[model samples]
Target: MVNSKIQAAEENLIHVYNRFPIALEYGDGMYLYDTEGKEYLDFAAGFAVCGLGYNNKELNEALKAQIDKICHISNLYYHVNCGEAAKELNRISGMDRVFFTNSGSEANEGALKAARRYAYTKKTGRFEFIAMEHSFHGRSFGAVSVTGHEAYREPFEPVLPGVRFAEFNNLDSVKALVNEKTCAIILEPLQGEGGIHPAKQEFMEGIRKICDENGILMICDEVQCGMGRTGSMFAWQDFGVKPDILTMAKAIGNGIPVGAFAMTQEVADFSLKPGDHGATYGGNPLSCAAVKKVIEIFEREDIVGHVKKTAPYLEKRLEEVAGEFEFVTGRRGKGFMQGLVFSRPVSEINLKTIEEGLLVIQAQGNVIRFLPPLIAEEKHIDEMIEKLRRALRKLQ
Candidate 1:
């Protein structure tokens, strides 16, 4: 039976998303409550955005205080939280300058624009970008242009031109795509929607070297794998390689709609100046306040350290669970961003898991992607496994 709220939402909303049947009312810690007050262990973390989990006192208080003070002062002038948030992001991400956006897609859009602007400024005539096959960037025109999935790009034909796709983790394929007109090579250090594929260390190093040799910008879309989800500030940090431009979102604001694309000092010096790019609500005080508080909580609580400690346990349990399920072929991913590869489509299993009061999501390649909150502990992992086992048993 459909609830009134869900029915109303469906009526009012565009038919873009195939939303889950659960209509959540609130959440606490690692659990979410539906309108009927059924408790559900949240493993999806709202598609890897809500890192701090639900009803965080510190995060809530920060937003309340900011609401009393100011929300939107526009980008025409400076604000307190914006600069502080950018500084903290820079301190953690190793990038020099940042331009805030409202979502991950916008961050990628800004990054692509910055890359083009840098080439334009350099008079290099480099206008092309090399992106990875099976990589997910975003849905916007600029972002979708470089996105490798045919389904994402086919509907929006003639997206930004001069983009080529290379097989992920294949240095030779990436090299074959590079040319004089290649301005940037963009990839996710750990792909989220593309089946939890992590870039090989050699592949990362080789891309960095190629970019260095060819004067092409290396853009890392850390939208899903960044913000300590990989037990590092950015997934690229894990590879010991740095991108010329870094695009991030998802967990940065801990559920608030905020994202940022940062650049090296050299790229900043040459790209997106005074009138080049801007956003009306991008760096507004409200979103920056959220970003500021989230980072503060991460540092004070050592969220990354917690993830480093807990990830191995999660991985071990997933391995055990996969071993128990005949259809589950294997597992992959880093830190809390793990996935179990199944021999068949995960849609029915995901629905069954939700019915079993465990919230998990799906990815490409018939995989069940698990992006639990960064604050998830061993007990949470155990509970998730138990519930998941029930779902798998019923399905089998």
Candidate 2:
């Protein structure tokens, strides 16, 4: 029987998520408990947002202490948590200044504004942006303009014009799209929602050269593949290419709502002046404290190194599972952000997996995305593999 309280929530709430039809009451490490107390292995990790895992002791303590102190304060004033968080971000990202926001889309919005403002200052007649086909930035109006998926853009037509699309991992496509009218070339180093495709090294280097030649800014959207998700603090570090502007969220504040955009000192000073842009709860103490602790734990626990060690094991196990199924096409992605592409449509498989108590995310192009927490242990990996095997066997 469905809980009356949960049913009330379903009735009252807007249907944005179209969730798994189960009410998650709590989670610990890589497992979640439904309202009925059924435990499920969570490979989705709140859609890749929870990096450190749920109910982490360090994170809980930090948040509790901050709650006792202060939850929020406007960005108009100086805040200690904001300063500390910014310092930690700068250290981690190698960027100069950070603009805080509440979500990944907002961070992308800020980056877009910065690109335009930079062009405006130069009077370069460069108002257009070049994005990639099958790329997902965010849902905000500015972000949607650069997002390449037609379905997401169709309903919200006439979204800020002059946005162009190029083929992802295809340097020639980007070169052809970029010209005098381009203000920036924005893309993810690893495409997340577009079925976990990692940008080739040559492709990234080619784009860097093209952007430099065209005098256009390069922005890397690391919202999903960043923050130790790809066994590194930022995915660009893996490619050895640095963007003029970087946008990130997801694992930044762990489960807390926080996002950030960073740029070089020159770009930040010239493009993003004070009073140019701001968010109400952007740099609130609560979010900042959470981010600070998240970074601290990532470093102290060597979470990235742990992911590097564990990812290969998970990948090998997934390969073995795929070997058993004729319909399994291939595995893609890096570190913990892996995807299993199937020969057949995966919607039925996803539903069956959910029924068997495993949580996975469905991505475009018949792929099942796996984004487990960075702190997931060997036992968690084994559990996920066993559940997936059971689900696949039943499908056969």
Candidate 3:
């Protein structure tokens, strides 16, 4: 049955990804079951999208209730949930206004636009952006233009101009690029796709300070690192720095499709007018309901505290596995988002771990990223490390 499904995907669907050889049927808690009922310990969590884990009862109920009432009512009309979702996000993120989008890409796009438009009123001819190397924003033209990786951008040459690259975690490099034409400096607080590297406190503070001194908007791509992954509503909170604009997605709606870019009242005022930007199904009723429920669940359960508690155990377990496996080069990241860097390519270990019923994310080709649900317990960490041990033993 799984084989047939894979064949059908190959025959009918576009060949964009070289997916793992299992058809996930359903997921519950920290585990996913395949079509054949083989259980896989889920550390990937759909690349940090499934923060509450799979089959969340409250979230399911919320979506179901909203489905019965109304699933979508585009931006032309009001959905109480839509406004409520934005209110909740603003209340937590400290941003003055919110613009709902469809994905992290769209949110980043909005952030970029907000930066440029705000700069338009503040400074003359400030259209350039300085982004960090090794950063992965998204695949959209604007998002990809700011993304620093060569491979992701090389495909779509002649990307949105006025974008320059700087080394991540280096303040001097960013300052070197800042000139009269610079509008914003964008970076991930903890880079998810670029090997799970977290910025140091000084670096983050420097970025914030630079943005302030230069009148440049500091835009954080919190799509992967936000939603309590780093033991806060937003990862920038850990650094004691607030962004001029922040973009969040992935876990914000649990598993639903919703994203948002928020900014200060000043930026929001100058950014986009009625004719400038819009999304048709951006903040529909159903997705906003999911967002509300997810935020409520996080607050009620103290999900950030849960991640903070379990993260040390997860890190310790990964360290032990590294001590046992010589190929394990290092570990990095904060809270629930971490990566085990390998001496060689991670492709073998990734597949081997999947074969042994553990699902982890492969990042930057040589790192195995663990982005477990925020609800993951110590037992889940133990299971993940034990399965990783099995996979590493195969290599030895």
Candidate 4:
């Protein structure tokens, strides 16, 4: 089965993902079982998407129940689950409205469109947005255009115009770029693809202040950092700042492909009209069921409290690894969304760790990112740390 699956993917699938030499078939809790029945510890959480872990009993039952009831219903009509999901998200985020999409990229695209429309409503020709350097939004044309990595943007040139790049955590730099044409500024609370760099408290406060003083819209793309992956329900919650608009995906559905962009009451009131923007597959019943269930589980299980309690143990273990390894240079991020920086690229370390029966992920700046499920306790943390240590020892 493993060989057949690998061969099938190699023959038919697009060669975009840098897939490891493993053919995984199933997962339970924080462990994944390959086609060969080899169990491996999971720390990647499917790139921070599987927050509830795999085959969660409640989630499975919910999905089964939803399947028996209904799955896909077009956006032209309303579904009960979709409305409930939107209401729950709004309650959690303090946002007034929700627009769902198939993936994080589409959610961010929606937010950008709303921003442009909001600006046009306020004043004509307000199209520009300020994005930060080393930030990753998504891969769609508009999203990639605002993304800071030149490599991702160079080949896909002529991306949306009027977008400018600014140094992250530098309020002065952001202030310098603001003008009448500027409509919004989008950033991640903790940059996931940019090596898990969490925003400093002062920086987040400054961004909020700058946006308020300038009458500019604020966007926080929490695709990789939301859904209680951090200690708070959302990364922005940790800093006591709120955004005019917010985009979320990944763990929102705990592996189900669901995404959403939200806006404040005033922004929703003035932004895109009925005919301006829409998604055909957005907010379908099946996906909405998953989203609603994930949110409910988080609240009922106190997943945020678990993350807040167990993250320090993971952090201390990572710090100890850094102290022991000469090549280890720095650590960044907070709560469960953490990364360890090395003086050299961590591709080998990542591969070696996978071979050592652990799954991890990589980010920019030689970062080995650790995003375990919110259910991870001290035992999982200790096991992950020991496996990581074994991998690092191989480098020596």
- Candidate 1 error regions (>4 Å): none
Worst 10 residues of 1 by lDDT: 73-82
User: How many clashes does the backbone of model 4 have?
Assistant: 0
| Top model number, lDDT | 1
The global Cα lDDT (0 to 1) of model 3 is 0.91
List runs of model 2 lying over 4 Å from the truth: 1-3
Tens-digit lDDT track of model 4 for 1-396: 458889898999989998898999999999999998989999999999999899999999999999999888767787889899999999987788999998999999999999999988987577899999999999999999989999999998888999999999898898899997888999999999998888889988998888888888899999999888889998888898999999999999999899999999899988989889988888988899999899999999999999999888889988998899999997777889999999988989988998889999999989999999889999998999889899999998
Top TM-score: which candidate number?
A: 1
Better of 1 and 3 by lDDT: 1
In model 3, what lDDT does residue 343 have?
92
lDDT of each: 0.94, 0.91, 0.91, 0.91
Measured against the true structure, the TM-scores of the candidates, in listed sequence, are 0.99, 0.98, 0.98, 0.98
Candidate 1 RMSD to the correct structure? 0.7
Q: Write the per-residue lDDT of candidate 3 for residues 38-154, one digit (tens) a residue.
A: 999999999899999999998999999999998877588888999999999999888889999989999999999988888776656799999999999999999999998899999
Which lDDT value does model 2 have at 314?
A: 87
